[model samples]
Target: MPWKNQSGGPWGSGPKGPWGSGPQPAGPRPPDLEDLLRRGQDRLQQLMPGGHLSGFGIGLVALVIIVIWLFSGVFRVQSEELGIVLRFGKYVRDAQPGLNYHLPYPIETVLLPKALRVNTTSIGMTLVEDPARGNRTIMRDVPEESLMLTGDENIVDVDFTVLWRIKPNGAADYLFNIQNPEGTVKAVAESAMREVIGHSDIQPILTGARTATEQAVQQLMQKTLDHYGSGVLIQQVQMQKVNPPSQVIEAFNDVQNAKIDYERLQNEAQTYANRVVPDAKGRAAKIVQEAEGYKQQAVAEAKGQSARFLKVYDEYVKAKNVTRERIYLETMERILGHSQKLMVDGPAGQGVVPYLPLNELTPHRQTPATTGSARQSSGVTK
Candidate 1:
């Protein structure tokens, strides 16, 4: 009734409907299911030898399809990969690196995880793409991750990398136990590093304790991961940089230089002592030995003088007059031994005779001849 309207059957006097003249443009329409079914059946019959699809032909086609589906389960695992098989979304077993099979499709599936691949995670730094430099990636510092407190109540900046890999026998745990493996590794590494830094002094951390810190953090990370069943093997922990906070770095360097100078001065003083002490000891020993020699010589000479005096006293006591005359003669000989001399041979009351123009005459006399002549004359007079 709506189509048969008053104005020429609602189409404005056109026998062809809403579309205007020149051959109606085609519009969308639902597919004919019966036609499609008939065409498929005709194609199946044509493929058969007798131009009809028998029960046997249908069964044969299904068998071929089933065989192809069954063969689809076969897969190859690479040398570095481990295949994990799951049944109905539940873990079933692990497969080695070779040709392996599992139940096909919805019944079972296999996951290929790279068990031997090494992964690197960096803490305290991030890679960012630089568009100005032809899209190359550059490292950018993450201060929040890098800054840590030391045992000496100092803030230090530390950057490091962690090398890790999935355990060969624990690939299943690696895949299923941890949901964001890389993120978990980064968090654990940062936590471990902070713990180590917190227990260390700032000076050692910045200078000598880098390797120790790395080892400690790596061991701690491994332990924590194992406890969580993360199945991650820690290969190495590498420290990139450790330094005082930027604001205080210059002052820290100045302090280090001062310490180095102090040590240098100490070493120089020790060296001076090493060189000078032995020489002083040697001089002191020489002086002491000389003094000992001098003391011994003086004592021996005094003892000899005393013995001679006692012998003379004994002689004098035996013959007093003769001994006195001999002693006077000996005293005269000793007192006049090295002097120019003249002898007076007159009477006892006579005064001394004039002394030697002879001495002046022989001013260049040979001393041995003069002394011998004097000694012989004195002996004759006695």
Candidate 2:
């Protein structure tokens, strides 16, 4: 009735209807339910042999769909992956690599986690996209993560990387126990590194203890993750850099160089001592040996002289007069053997002359020149 009126339907008969404008142009109408039903029935009839859907045809169609749905449960697992099966959202069992099967969706499901793939997590640095540089990624240091306190109350900047992977036998725990595997690994790595650094000195950390720190951090992280059943296997921990804070780096380097110089000087002194001490000891030993030899020679000579004097005393005690007379004659012979002299038998009464020219009688007393000079001097004196 309103449509027949044509006065903007329910609104008043005027150019303005309802709120303001008059009636608008008719738009596209909604689809008719009866027409849609008739079309669907026609399509079904065309698909069926008797121009109508039968009970057997419906059953056969459902059977084919069910078969396809059942086959949809099949999945292929990669070689590096470990498949975990869940029933009714509960973990049921594990599946190995290759083709595997489980109940269809809403009943059972499979999760393929790469158990053998190595995952790397950096502790103190982040890669950020640089818009100014053509969207390239650049490493940005995080001071909060990199700076830590040492055992000696010193601060050190440390950057390290952790290599990890899902445990093969613990894939279920990896997925169920830990919500975010990589995040959990990163947090654990940072915590472990901080703990290790806290117990170490800054000097060794910046120098030769990098490998040791890495090993300690890895072991500690693995132990912690195991305690929580995180199902993470830590493969390796690598230290990217370890150094004193930038503010004190120059001073630290100077101190290290001084320490090196000190050690070098100590080594040189030790080497010199090693060389000189042996030579000094050898010279002292040689001097002592020479003194000992001289002492022995003196003692031997004194003993020989005393033994000879004792033998002579014993001979004197046995024959006093003869020994004395022989000693007197020997002393006189020794005293006058080289003298120029003549002996008288008696005082000017025997056949011996009182004075004799002993010097002239000796052939070896004077030469011809000496004799001529002597005669000339005698003549001159006469």
Pick the TM-score winner.
1
lDDT (Cα, tens digit) per residue for candidate 2, span 1-382: 2122123432232211112223322112223335544555666678988787787765665565567557767877788888776565567888888888877654655666777899999978999999999999999888899999999999998888999998869887776666567878889999999999999988788778888898999899999999989889999999998888889999989998999999999999999999999999999999999999999999999999999889878999999998899889999999977654444444576666455677666777678998779656552111
* Residue pairs with backbone atoms closer than 3 Å in model 2 (clashes): none
Against the true structure, what is each candidate's TM-score?
A: 0.73, 0.68
How far residue 143's Cα lies from its native spot in candidate 1, in Å, is: 1.7
Error of 2 at 28 (Å): 38
* CA lDDT of every candidate: 0.77, 0.76
lDDT score of residue 187 within candidate 1: 98
Residue 33 displacement (Å), model 1: 21
Deviating ranges (above 4 Å) for candidate 1: 1-58, 341-382
What is the per-residue lDDT of model 1 for residues 170-228, given as tens digits with 9 covering 90 to 100?
87677667666788899999999999999999988877888889999999999999998
In model 2, how large is the Cα lDDT of residue 343? 42
